[model samples]
Target: MKVVETVSGIRETLANMRTAPGKRLKVGFVPTMGYLHEGHQSLLSKAKAECDIVVLSIFVNPLQFGPNEDFDKYPRDSERDLRLAEQSGCDVVFMPSVQEMYPNPIRTSVSVKGVTERLCGASRPGHFDGVAAVVLKLFHIVQPDKAYFGLKDAQQVAVISQMVSDLNVPVDIVPCPILREADGLAMSSRNVYLSAEERREALVLSKALGMAERLAQEEGLTFEALRNKIEGEIRSTPLADIDYIEVLSYPELEPVDPSMETVSRTSDMIVALAVKFGKTRLIDNVILHRK
Candidate 1:
């Protein structure tokens, strides 16, 4: 129920949390840009169940946005988000200003190689560097014992996991399941920008991924065949413009070669897709793990 705007204030509060006499509380952090939804609520719900104190930080990090990206236009509603956070069982909400986080004009950034070379990383360029930098800053600021992220942004999750592992960040990175609409569209803040018609078309992203998953379960379907089928499904929708339809190894995110025997029915894989419906770009994914 407490809201802290300044980094120092939150740090001081968190310090008290650790040193407070009697019970030592376990902190869980969920870092996000403001506009709250069912997906974000799902993360907080999980965090609340697992940790004693849940810290939700709502800062639309400029560091993670490209020059021409939607940082300025990104949807934000802190009042509503704050209410939702409290309802979702958040103990504190950290809402910091851009200037406060970057008082001196940022000159440093974090990056993880290999994992950042494909999918959203390749398309956005320097996007993961911004994400890594901002996340590290938040992780330091919140000082949570565990940080929660959703599986919808699988690439982002992979990048963060890699950064945490490589740098030995002392926190558990917990990824929750992707929460979808009743119609199967993955929830996103940008979903607000979609026109009514575009919203309908956007379901193709999930539908295609569903097809990919089904194909993966069938015998004799190569990686290429599954990818091609998924791509075809997206292209069939008049409003959907393909950004990227990729089938890659999970966590590692390396593209799966069709000729490789490792890509058979029993292989673990991720089907990721990004599509543009008019000016709104949306991303979704499905993880395949068959025994």
Candidate 2:
């Protein structure tokens, strides 16, 4: 129920908690923007269960949004978000202002090299750099033993994992399953941007991934054939424009060779996609393992 707004305040609070009595603090952290949903709650709930204390940070990082992206218009409801966090068993909410986070100009940033150049990175330009910078900042600020992220942002997950490994950050990165609506659309704060008709069209992203999964499992299609089928479905939709439909190695995120026979034998493949519905961009993915 406690809300700390400054980085120093959060660090001080955690330091105080560390020395309190006989309790050994096992901190679980979930970093997110201020719009609470089932997806965000899922991570918080899992964190609460696994750790003695759960900390959730709700800061809409400006660094992560592109010049044309919706950093300003991104949905935010801190009051509701706090209630949801409390209900989900969070111990503290770290809600820092932009000034508190970046009082001075930022000079440094983190990037994951090769994986940062593919898929979403190819389209968004400095997107992954922004993500890496902000996430590293959060990891340092919270310094949780374990941190949770939704698998819905598979590329983000992949990028974070790379950053953690390469930089040797002392935190466990855990990726939870994608939380979805009743009709199967993945839950997102930006989902509010969808007009009724565009909302219906948006489901195509998940449907396309579903088709790719089926082809991979039942039809025994090659990765090339599977990708083509998925792309063809997106192209058929009038309202959906494809950003990228990639089947890549899970952790490293390198593209899988369509001609390689070992593609079917690999257990860690990710079918990830990003699509534009009107002015809004949404992402979704499915992880596949050969059975």
- Name the top TM-score candidate: 1
- The true-versus-predicted C-alpha distance at residue 234 of model 1, in Å, is 0.8
| Candidate 2 per-residue C-alpha lDDT over 1-291 given as tens digits, one digit per residue, 9 for 90 to 100 | 789999999999888876768877888999998798999999999998899879999999989888988888898899999999999999889999999999998999777898887888998889999989988998999899999999988888888998999889999999999999998899999999999999999888888888777777654467887888899999998999888888888777887677654345556888888899999889999888856
Give per-residue CA lDDT, model 1, range 1-291, as digits (tens). Answer: 899999999998888777757877899999999899999999999999999889999999887788999999999999999999999999999999999899998888688999999999988999999999999999998889999999999999999999999999999999999999999999999999999999998988888888777777777777887888888888899999888888888878987676654346555688888889999989999999964
Candidate 1 lDDT trough over 10 residues, lowest sum: 258-267
TM-score of 2: 0.96
The candidate 2 region of ten consecutive residues with least summed lDDT is: 258-267
Q: Each prediction's Cα RMSD?
A: 1.2, 1.5
The CA lDDT at 277 in model 1 is: 98
Q: Please report the candidate that would top lDDT against the real structure.
A: 1
Error of 1 at 132 (Å): 0.2
